[model samples]
Target chain A: MTPEDMDLLAALGRTRAGLKVEADKHYVVESRLAPLARREGYPSIEALVAALRAKREERLIWAVVEALTVNDTAFFRDRATFAFLRETALPELSRRRKDGSVRIWSAACSTGQEIYSLAIAADEARNLEPGVRFEFFASDLSERCLEKAQSGLYTQFEVQRGLPIRLLIKHFENHDETWAISPRIRQAVRWRRINLMSDLSGMGAFDLVMLRNVLPGLDLSVRARLIENLAARLTEDGLLVLGEAESLAGVTEALHPVAGRPGVFARDPAYRAAAA
Target chain B: MKTCLVVDDSRVIRKVARRALEDIGFDIAEAADGMEALAWCRAAMPDAVLLDWNMPVMNGLEFLQRLRQEPGGDAPVVVFCTVENKVENIRLALDHGADEYIMKPFDGEIIAAKFAEAGLL
Candidate 1:
């Protein structure tokens, strides 16, 4: 393949694996990435792709992946999902847990929105269970996103999207015009860099997993592989949520759709039966 | 003032719904889940219910199904509050006896108009 063709394929490969890019929109990708290429001392996208393909340095490959992962997320991207989580999911999960602690994992959490939203959800759930112990794990593939997630700072526009005025007052302090997530909520979540393609055993099991808005990027094989990986970390009766647009259709046999909630599925009892 | 029950798991959404309804002279009651909503409805019948689709213990669909079976003087109008903007979900909500369907992150004026459409205003 030619240098340009290789660049296109690499971009396509990464984008399909949930690292974000509008590969079809070449000019837009080029414009957004030009500065990174310049900073990395590469003259063109072809040169950058060549360097990335050579894989001489792991850090360079990561930089390309980081650039490709679209971190375009708001405080609460989809309001209803969080609503369901706070009112229904957490409370129910809390009741089912033999231990007072509820474990929630925000898989592929980008820039802290999903995890922060979970913190807010957990706080809402706490209203029902005052002494509820929460173990929140927020993981992503990009170290850059993890740093931002760790910082817990958001722009005014970012805060305005799904954050309520009351939550703003209660959980965030104004850092000049930028809103900073409270230390309590920030501390509630433990952020880490985790590639979904790798082993997730060390993270332990979770009662609830928010895997929303991240999956459609993979091919059918990778999608199924990722779901199988995720399913292992979920408790037997645990809930697995996906983005409103994403689905488990043909992805994995381990999960079956929950009756009422679209894009939300649970471990298949039949699979459990077979395993048992 | 007309009483409206806002059933959602998210505090932010509940606050937003309450504020929107209150601005149009409606008293608001809040429920975080289906069981709480059903209990609240049994005790005090609100003029309307703003129900969310995907809640934890009892989701909106299950709540609607239960609410329909109960014997009450007058059943409150139920308008589904959701982010599932798909037409099929809306149709499902309506089929399950939801009077109307409203998408979330909506403007206050639109909420007020929904109340008016429901004749609660």
Candidate 2:
């Protein structure tokens, strides 16, 4: 790929999707966009990159990014992460809540798995304390994934990823070849398109925000900024969950690990005191 | 939007598959044999692949296995669109990572439904 193409692809990935496409991965980018170039009537990758640089076709630019956006997720992808939510995080948040309701946000909740996992956990949690309620907000950068998630449908491979057979039978109904999640579970959650790189203040405060399995791929500055931004929206007594491998250790001081839970975090008291 | 790469030794087969997929609004590409298909996939990963068996060069099973070894190999949804309908052949293709299988002499309707079943359409 030419230097110009690299720059254009890199810029588009960064600005539009929070994806940082390295020069080495140009093959991945080119292959993804080659079909786009053909469909859009650009003769070659060069022509496509040139057109993208010269003018911004909203649809074309988005097509490239969308193609590059890999909707890689499965239900309860990390057992420990969801286990934390079911056992410790949700219960602690429930006890502290003034209202019977608790709001949980699943940022970049790709294909609805992570958010739905939370909903299942919330459902299980509610059974123990009949009065407590759960409200969910799930958002992703890819509109395609959001659509799939909103449908609450999954293929066999998707359901087999980590969903226990019991929950699968109880919460989902088979439709042709796919499993459509039960309406009650679907109704408990809200879906939206939100690129984390942009403003997030519009989404109001939440008691638990599951931004798991997403940080390690990002640039250091981006990781820090995103963590800080998410922390800002947490209610004073809220929790922020990261992938097991992720951390706020060096990223930002706005959030810190809650003493006992491994991947769960809370706004640092010093930061909170200072903010107030 | 979804993308698909149709691979077959027969030009007519490739043509038909491409047309059928294009009508469904897929951005489609084609390769005549497994060797060319491997090159295409290594460069950029398609959302799905419609593959064929019994090619002169690397066969579909060979290509699928080799492709699985490449970086980002797990990304594509593969459907073995071939004449090999033997139980062993189907099992082998599925074991080799073919997401679905369709017999030859298929139409747009079959293509649409199979792809839909594979969660690609």
DockQ of each: 0.03, 0.02
Q: Put down candidate 2 lDDT per residue, A1-276, tens digits, no spaces.
A: 697678878777777767767777878778778877898899998888788777888977887787666567778766667766787667766766635788899998878998988889878764235566778999988787899999998875566566754466668876544778999999889988888989989888898898876775565558878888898889888878887766677677787776545667877554333212
Q: Candidate 2 — number of clashing residue pairs?
A: 1
Backbone collision tally, model 1: 4
- Candidate 2 chain A, poorest ten consecutive residues by summed lDDT: A267-276
- Positional deviation of A165 in candidate 2, in angstroms? 1.0
lDDT of each: 0.75, 0.79
Provide the TM-score of chain B versus the true chain B for each model in turn: 0.95, 0.96
The C-alpha local distance difference test score for the whole of candidate 1 amounts to: 0.75
Best by lDDT: 2
Docking class of 1: incorrect
